[model samples]
Target: MSKVDADTQSKWDEQLDYKKLPDWKDCASILNKRCQYLEARDSKQIRSEQCVKTFNKNSSTKPTIVNPHRPQTSLAANQRSCILCRDLNHSITNCKKFLELSVMDRFWKTKKLGLCLNCLVKGHSVSRCPSSYKCKTCEQAHHSLLHRTQPADTNSGIDTPSDTSGQSTSAATHSAMEKEQVPEAQVILATALLLIKDSSEGFQLGRVLLDSGSQVNFINEKFANSLGLRKHRKNVDIVGIGVTETKIKYQTQSTIRSRYSNFEISLEFLVAPSITGYQPEASLNVSSWNLPSNLELADENFNQPSQIDLLLGAEAFFDLLESGQIKLGEGLPSLQQTALGWIVSGRYKSKYNTTKKASCVANTLEVGLDKYFEKFFEFEEIQGLRSIWSEEQNECEKHFIDTIKMLPSGRLMVQLPFKKHPSCLGGSYDIAFRRFLSLERRLSKNASIKSQYSDFLKEYERLGHMSLVPNPNLDEDHYYLLHQYVLRPDSVSTKLRVVFDASCCTSSQISLNGILMVGPTIQDELLIILLRFRLYRYALTADIVKMYRQFLVNPSDRKLQFILWRENEPTPIQTYQLNTLSSVFG
Candidate 1:
């Protein structure tokens, strides 16, 4: 194990070479021949008789040698309290109370003391005792087998404790029921890596928490839905410490395989909400749930998802525990067995640390497409909508520029404007432009992306979303600007969309025309909307197609939304101005 040990072993090996020695039988023969040669002694010594006398003397042995100076017993050794009589200065065997008892009574007393019948010692029974003494009754090594006494009927005349309150049996039952209804521990949660077996996917890696006290196993709704699991609706009440009168409204059947002990089991799980009331004490705090190091889980949506999923529960836990399929270690309070494959609980030493608030730039998705759909669609309906949007493009961009051109702009028009624009938004144009160029190059080779972008541009051009301006018509009267493009793969439409930043900088000065725009908020304040939704049994939800592009700007404000555009890499660049509010206007 260590360099020192290895060197020591090598040095020890150099002292002997067994391979160079004589064969076993040959060596034995040589030894025998030497013994025969020494068999004869000098005639005056009477060698044969002398040899017999020497052998007989050595054959008979005495008790093993011990220190001659040490006493047989010490004051400290004798002072320990006797395990049997609870007395000092002597052990259980030599107790005066034990000696005074009858033989049969002593046997029962020894049994009560849980001592080794053979050695008359505590800590071990006769079967495992090292004593060589045989049973006094049967002359067998096991003292328990030879000693038999009829069991006493101690409860024959014993009366059960009666309630002093004179309550009826039903009332007593109610009191007992009340005690049983409440439990001490909320849930014993064990997080382990598991192998889940699916009909289509044989064994996939999963992180699960086994709840030994629960009546049924639970799977996270989000995780289950991701796996495309089929569900059956059921309203099952869940009663626990600090839990509300709540119910699990769904159930699903699935098979989970644990390779920890090479075991697999199929069962139906009540699809409970994995995210319940957050209790700092009830959750495991770890860097990530993935087994070993979690670098592999970087691409996944959850580095540490719900701590409770696949609760083994009372129904399954006891069976596995008894069969030796699940082994628990007390030192680290870890569980190891087959459930997901050989898995041990991860290190959960720290308290739950609340995540920090993200910076402004990281909050780009605050008013994103994902957020808009979540506000309107129900759980299952969102899935269907996403599937459709992924393959289809909207047609509402056809009239944006046309409508903007028709709007009258005169000296009489009132301007609602801000004095200062947000300077932080100005420096990102070059980076966004480079990203757009990279996306365009990727789209050139990808048919799906190319077709999706083509359909998007077709609708935008047909709707007059932008109007081209000749190079000669460019004037100092308007501030020339450019909008960057963004590729949102997570969205339903994985196409490149232009990002219009009206706050774009021109030579470190804010654009006066850009400052003259005011946008109307379409989404309602969320708190009030949520309160109203909860009050209605039936409510209508609608999403306007091409939501932002549907709103048109005045012809006077269109020039402030100008951008440089080229149809192809070799084509002459042209100036174009957007006529509708794009995604960034939010």
Candidate 2:
């Protein structure tokens, strides 16, 4: 081993002097143990510092401990002195005066008492509390007594529990004093799982939320894209709680069907980037709650947090609701009968100190606007706006510049800009093979198309665009691209062309295009080019023959561009590595 650093040597010397070891062996053992202890202590200190920094970054205000050096107190001792009424006979839970306060008021009282939200115990915050017990209702890390509940009719807007009785004046005074101490309430929204028809007429199970407060129906943009539905451009502003606005740029129509009954409806939804964050926020235990055994739940996993794919607004909400309704209890979600099925909604009572209420509003707009402004200012220059590129796009451009080289034959050689190492690209040979078999079956029905495809491959091989793999066994970093043909019967130059599917998913459910960086557009738009052509006295148009083949890929990356093929059924399938850049690849 190398000699110890100065700091380490000094530490060892100090330990040895203090211990006064007799032999070198004893001194070494003691030094080793001391070093481990010091290392652990330093690591722990570093972790604590990191945690504090993270906490400070997330919290708007820092917590203040009035007496940090005070001796730790237990729950039994705290119970003797109620924070609400200072009663010596009973604890906060049993205190009659505390029970008289509203749920919102109780929440503020708990905050003021400086007790742990999870256990309502003194001496530690919720994060440091050793208790594993959580709120029975929401299963969140909070005491059940402090759990707040809102009305089931979330569409009517948030209704704060007010003490509107004889003590209204005093209640108002207390409310004003504890306005800042109020925490966001957490309430469960009505969600259901319904069958949504895709473009292919196939039905997919999607999680839909019933939001009567929203004037128009909304769908998650990513989910809408996955359905392959035709979208029409229709920009509109969606305003939600606190006048928060989000721009919806597209709208699509989809048919939804009930899983239990023959109920079906066609609905139009405005597409947004995201509907809302995950519902429930966290998972809940529903085993204890006695639900109706005869009723079939729309969403079986309503207790679990999940992505909301579609939101049915007021237009559809009222139409779907039936007259049937069942109340479970005062603190439990009530089952409401709808065309879709029985959906659980309403106030659930628990003892959590605070709950983060989930709303149909888009809360991320401010952060998005901040980022947009930051980018706008960053790219502003004397001449005009500089080219704006994301970090991924910039990295892609740099990768191309760094890895691109000119071969002896004057062909440009480049490496694939993979976001991750190639080893992580799981097995794709089976998928490619299956796709190839399907393509073969389709081609067999048309002899002319099959012959044309064979000729194209023959020409491709003749020109050295691709070569047979010497060994059929795939390497750890290998990938296979599924190949298909696109028929351009109207084209004079090429009637048939083979296209490689770079987006074909592997066993890992990730494709080459998914992990690869699609570099920014290097060519000008067609509209811009056409407009510039009009400015010239003479305009000429030409096409470069075999344009995609001009650029060659590096030898090391050839394995990742493998394809399977067989001219005839009698012959075994063969693997070929593409040597040149293809137009279809991202």
Candidate 1 lDDT by residue in tens digits, 1-586: 1222454445434544555533345534544654454443222244344345335354555333221111114443365467776877765544556544434455678788887676565655555554455654445653432132211321221111122253332333334333322322222234555666543344666666545657777777766775556688889877665454456788888877654455667788777555332222322323233234422221122223344344556676655542223223222223344333333432332221222121110101134777556644443232321222111012112222223343343212212233344331233334435545665686678776666565665567678887776652333345445444567877775357755555555554554334443332335555547656756579898877777776676666565556555555677555676677656632
| TM agreement with the true structure for every prediction | 0.27, 0.40
lDDT tens per residue, model 2, 236-317? 9877778877777899999999999888999998988778878776676566678878788988888888999999989889
| Candidate 2 Cα RMSD (Å) | 21.7
C-alpha lDDT values of all predictions: 0.47, 0.73
Return the top candidate by lDDT. 2
* Residue 140 of model 1, lDDT score: 60
Clashes of each: 13, 12
> What is every candidate's alpha-carbon RMSD to the true fold?
28.3, 21.7
